[model samples]
Each structure stands twice: as C-alpha cells, then as structure tokens.
Target: MTGRPTTASAVLPAALRAWLGLIAVLAALTAVVIGIQYAGHSEAGRADRWFIDPTADSVRGTWRNVALATDFWGEPAGAALLVVAAVAGCLLLRHRRGAVLVVVGAALAVVATTLVKSVVGRTIHGADNLSYPSGHTAFATALAVAVALIATGRLGLGRAAGLSLVLGAALVAGAVMGWAQVALSAHYPTDVLGGWCTALTVVPLTAWAVDRAADSRRSDRS
Candidate 1:
C-alpha cells in the first residue's frame, strides 16, 4: 500500500472535509437565526411584524392567491411527492446510490428540522405551536437540493448550463415557498432562513455519510 490511504478513504476524505466547512457555516447561520428569535431582537421582530401585518393585507388579492398556490410546494404532501419523484428518477436512471443518498438526506433533514423547531420554541402569531425553523421550508429546500444533486449527476460533464438551469429552477421554487410562508404569516423571515440553513447543513452531510458508507462496503467486498 506504500503508506498511501486506500481508495475508499482517499476519495471520501477530501469531499467530507469540504462538506465539513459548509456544514459548519450553515450550523453557525442556523444558530444566529435562532439566537435572534430567542433574544427578541428588534430586527427579527420588526421583520416579522412588517411582513405579517400590512404587507400581508396589502397582498390579499391576486398576489396572495399566487403566493398561496406557490406555498403548496412546501406542504407535506407536496414535499413527499417531490422526494419520491427524485428518488424514483434516480432509480429509473440506475443511479441507485443517488436514490439512497436523496432518501437518507431528506429524511435526516426532516428530523433535524423538527428537533430544532422544538428546541428553539419560537412561535408565530397565528400558529399553534413553536415555529423557529419552518418545517415546510426545510422540506422544500431539502427536496430542491436532492433533485439538483440527482440532476447534476445525470447531466454529468459538458452540461454546465443544463445543470445550472435545473438547480436554479429548483432553488427558485423553494424560495417562492419560503416567501409564501412569510406572506401568509405562517412563519417569520428568520424562521424561513433557519429552515434553509438546516437543510443545507443536513443534506450535504447526509450525502457525504452515505457516500462513505457505500465506499466502505465496496472496499470490504473487494
């Protein structure tokens, strides 16, 4: 072996190390978002009030309808459908690893979002319970990322434009859902941001872990 790392370990470590940096950044952002909520910062309060008050009322016509329609993308049923579609697409393309990664990453994201929301204990005016991190936004963001990953893998090299378009559309759709949450007074701005940070943190780390586990399994077989 010439003192070199094995192929599985070498391949996994570089990607995992890069993801660690991203995960740390996202974790810090999530913390800051939640901290602002918990500290009762004026900025957070003002933003929430501004969005939920007159702004919500001002948009109560056609714009509100559009936002309401867009918000469906983040609903539990919609998110589940998106996840299933992404995983099924991967499987149809014979990207079994991608399918597994998407499923694991999305599931972890949901669990993490729920736990964070419980721990943060932030609430919206019309909501029944805590709402620090919006579960709908988290699910939508995770679904978007999962679909982007699968699309990028399928597109491969020499298709940068195609990959970019696919990912951009997915992200834009997720952003629309987040905006809709604010417009509907379902969550604060910080809540949406916190959900996105949690999704970004959870998905990549979950994918890295899944990749490492797959690589280890292959190495064992070899």
Candidate 2:
C-alpha cells in the first residue's frame, strides 16, 4: 500500500530536516571549538598564525581595493542599504516571508555574534577590542543565507538543490567578508571562521522557526 499523500500541513521533508541538522551541528560545533581555543586571548593562536603572513601583507593594491569594496557592504550604512534592497527584491518576488527572514535573520546573527564575542573575550589589535567573531562577516553571511533560502522556496527546489544553493551562498558570502576582514587586519582569521559558522548555525534554525510560526497561523485560521 502507498503512504498517505503529503499536505500543506506536513512537516519538513526528511532530507531537508537532516540537512539542517547537519549544518547546525557542524557550524555550532566549529564555532564553539574556535571560541574555546581563543577565549581571553588577544593574539592569533597557532592555527591563526598559519594563515597570517608575518613579513608581508597578503592583500594589496587591486585586491585590497576589491576587499574594501566587499567590506563596505558589511558596515552599518552599507548593511542597512543592503537590507532595504533585499526586502524590496523579496516583495518583487512576492515572498513576504522571505523579506521578513532577511531583516530578522541578519539582525539576529549580528546580535548573536556580539553576545558570543563578549563571552569569548577574544580580542585583536588591542585589549579594548573584542573580536572573537567578525560582525561584518556574520552580517554578509546571514544575508546570503536568507536569499538562498528564499530562492529555494520560490523555485520549489528539491532537497539536494535547496541544500546546495543554501550552502553555496553561505560559503561565498562568508569567504568574501571573511577575507576582507583578515586583509584589512580588522580581525583574526579564526574570528572570521567564527563569524561564518555563526550565520550557518543561526539562519537555517531561524528559517525553520519562521516557517513553523507561519504554518501555525494558517492552521489556526483554517
């Protein structure tokens, strides 16, 4: 006998749920490990030294300019502009839920990083600076994850395609912003890694929560 048909009220597909669980576990675990290793520290650790060049700046000239351009999008004014544009794009695509996700996800990622930084007590440049996780990197990654999730739903993609899109977007955005932070000496390489993981951990969970809440409201009305 065949199984019952899927309905609008059905929970997330098993493949998608498993994918989310994997992403969340790995991301959160990585962030925690890095934070523990660097807690209450100001200088780059052994792992960080491998990535940082002692004698020369790795990013320079044209590449430095590119990095700066990418970095700008993570700044306060730039991030605000990005949010406005993203929200407009979501509306144009007729995805109000996606628009809300973009706004809320980005804010939560940044806030989460800030709190983690405080607890991690990691610093760079000086004692006053607390930079375990790069907030800029977190913001960029969060935006990308939101967009990817929106695309997945809008296109009605399957498990593999949706997971691929989300992971790819998150990786690209995280790398771009993380590189910028390291090149500018704004944060340690490990800090960037922490930031990337923070978004990876937060965005998917937030999206799931949003879906549940929306579905609950719809069910109530029905």
Candidate 3:
C-alpha cells in the first residue's frame, strides 16, 4: 500500500535536482578559480608577490593579534568539537540520512581541499607553510555547508527561526576562521577561496541525495 510522499517528501524531487545542479556549478567555479590563480602565479616572481602583497600582510597581522588576545573560539579544536555536536544532534533528532550526508560532505570537502592544495603546492602569502587551500578555511567551509543543509533541509528550519538561528551562529564561527587565517597571515585570499568552493560544491548535492533516500524509505513502508 504505497502512497504519496509526506510533507517532507513532497519537496524532495525538485530540491534534489536543484541541489545536483548547484554542486556541479560549485565544482566548476572552484576549478576555474584555482586555474586562474595558477596562471596568475606562474609568471616571474608573481606567486611570491601575490601570496605576500604588503597591503594584505599589514592587515593580516592585526587580525591575528585579535585572535591571539581573545582566544575566543579561534581554535581549530573547538570547530572540530562543534562538528561532533552537530552530528550528534542530527542523530538524536532521527535525521540519520541527513546526518550521514553532512558527515560525508564534510569528509569529501577535506579530501578535495587536500588534493587541490597538494597539486597547487603554493605557499602562504608570507610564509613557506602549505597554503593553497587553507586548512582552517576548509574545516569551516565544510562544517558551515553541512550545518546550512541541516538547518534548511530535513530539519525544517526557516531562515529566521529555530535551526536558522543555530546556523547563523555556525556562520559566525566559519567567518571567524576565515578572518583569523587572513588576518594572522596563515593563508592568502585564494587559499580561503579554494576551500569554500570545494565545500559548497559538495554539500548541496549530498544533502539532496540523502533527502531522496529518506523519502524512499518512508514510501517503502507505507
């Protein structure tokens, strides 16, 4: 006695298709950005210059001081801990499919970021540290993307209500990482860009697929 989709399932098809399209777009855009950076730095002494332009360097130093002085949620460890909490919350709420998607999206974000960074092998703007894809940025982007999906998808949140509030908090945290990295001279603008592209490209499609699967499971039992 299978039946029509539930309120949740009703929106799954269109949303899933949209998400897939978005992921493809995100991937393409990220690739293009990385390519542009590569070409930009391939010239005589350009990579060095772009990575450490004095103007940005000056601003970055000040940002790092703010992070150092406050230590208020600037640690990567704190971000990781939040990931654990997000996953736990989803599981507790019986949003298993969505939770899995969030975790997978995050893991894939890390993998993609690592591969791109390694291939670029570009150093920080002012230091020799690996900096093609800022690791802190990667974590923040991945975590934020995952949280956004949960906030707006299966968890059923309005942008101005409930989970959206939490999502906003997460966004702030994500911004903190990006700002800290840029200000502290830990990464260049391009490094943060790559991380965001990688995460945004994956999260939507992954969430959509999970939503579809969850709908199917419900249909099977009905």
Candidate 4:
C-alpha cells in the first residue's frame, strides 16, 4: 500500500511541540498590541504620561548619561557584536548546537519584531514609525536568552543554581534596557512588554528547531 504524503505538521519535532505555550503567549501579546492600536484607546498615552513625564526631567542629568550608555548597549552594532561574540564563544567551546541557536534566535527575534511592528502599525508618543514592540528590548532579550543557552550548553551549568545565576544576570540586563527605553520615552510600557514576549517566544522556538535539526543530522549520519 502507498503511504500518505509527508506534511510539515507530521514531521514536527517534540521540542517544537513543547514550545507551543510560549508561542501562544507571544501571539496573545501581539494581539494585545494590535487590539490597543485598533481600539484607539488612550491607555498607552496615559501610561506615557504617567511613566515618561515623571522621569523626563530625572533622566536628563546623570541619568541621561546612564540612559545613553544603556541605549548604546541596545544599539544595532552592540547587539550584532554581542551575538557574534556569543556565537564565536560557542564555536570555540565546540557547542555547535548552541552556536546555531544563538545565531538563529537572534535573527528570528529581529525579523519577528520588525514584522510585527510593521503589521501592527502602533505608534508611541507621536512617533509614527513602528513602536509597538521596542527593538532595543527585543534585541537585549534575545541576546540574554542566547547567552543563557550558551552558558548552560557549553559550560555544563545545568544545575538549578547555575542556571538561575546565568539567567538572572541576563534578565537584569534586559530589564535595564527595557526600563531605559520607557524612561527615555522611546517606547510605551506595552512596547517593552511586547518586545520581551517576542524574544521569549522566538528564542525557545529557534533553540528547539536547532536541536531538532542536529538530531536529524545525527540520525541521518547514523
């Protein structure tokens, strides 16, 4: 008897299957951003007024210098260098899967963020050009996830404490960038949240795909 034709869904890996919850969360967050934009609500404006206005003057002095430094870390060049360094480190350590995860995760996060921002058409604080998801926050969050994956995979830091330590540092760094974006009035709070959700969704999905690919290659070789 002839077999049924193969489909993408039929070949989906368990690893990817496990990440459906995260993907759902990302979708929900994206929906929230879109809904807010379409509803023509003033909630975002109110949030900006509450968060940005109070901090505007405060971020202008020494805080301005700090914000500038934080902003630099979130810049495209900085994010690229971070990913490059991470991938290089993974390669040096011979963690090929981890390296692949870092590269692919970063790329996916960037592309997803850009696409969502474009499609959602959400603006923040009068900026018409894509602001629903903060690019800086997304970059930082993706970099953090990549770094965490590398640390666990390469360094064998699989213990709960070790994982916590690595992940905690990354979270703190990402949080700082998100806070800076909000304080600088570059994004509303929802934008930062959406960016984080995007990263959380993309990185794990990319990691699952990387692992599945490696497994398939191994199976083929064997």
How many clashing pairs in candidate 1? Answer: 0
Using lDDT as the measure, the top candidate is 2
lDDT of 2 by residue, 159-196 (tens): 99988988899889999899899998889889999999
Q: What are the models' TM-scores? A: 0.76, 0.90, 0.68, 0.77
Highest-TM-score candidate: 2
1-222: candidate 4 lDDT, tens digit per residue: 122212211122232344444554665567466545633332365655655563344367888788888888778787778888888977786667777777788788878878877767777555465686777887888778667655554444434644464447557866898888876777777778777777777776676666667667666666
In angstroms, the error of model 2 at 120 is 0.7
Quick one: ranking by lDDT, best first? 2, 4, 1, 3
Worst 10 residues of 1 by lDDT: 3-12
What C-alpha lDDT values do all the predictions have?
0.64, 0.84, 0.58, 0.66
Number of backbone collisions per candidate: 0, 0, 2, 0
Model 2 regions lying over 4 Å from their true place: 1-15, 54-58
Q: Candidate 1 residues 1-222, lDDT tens each?
A: 233333222212342345445554766576566655564322246655654563444358888998887777667776677778887877787776678867787778778878876666676553346777777777777667666655544544224543454347446755777888877777777787777777777766665676677666776766
Q: Flag clash pairs in model 4.
A: none
Clashes of 4: 0
Of 1 and 2, the candidate ahead on TM-score is 2
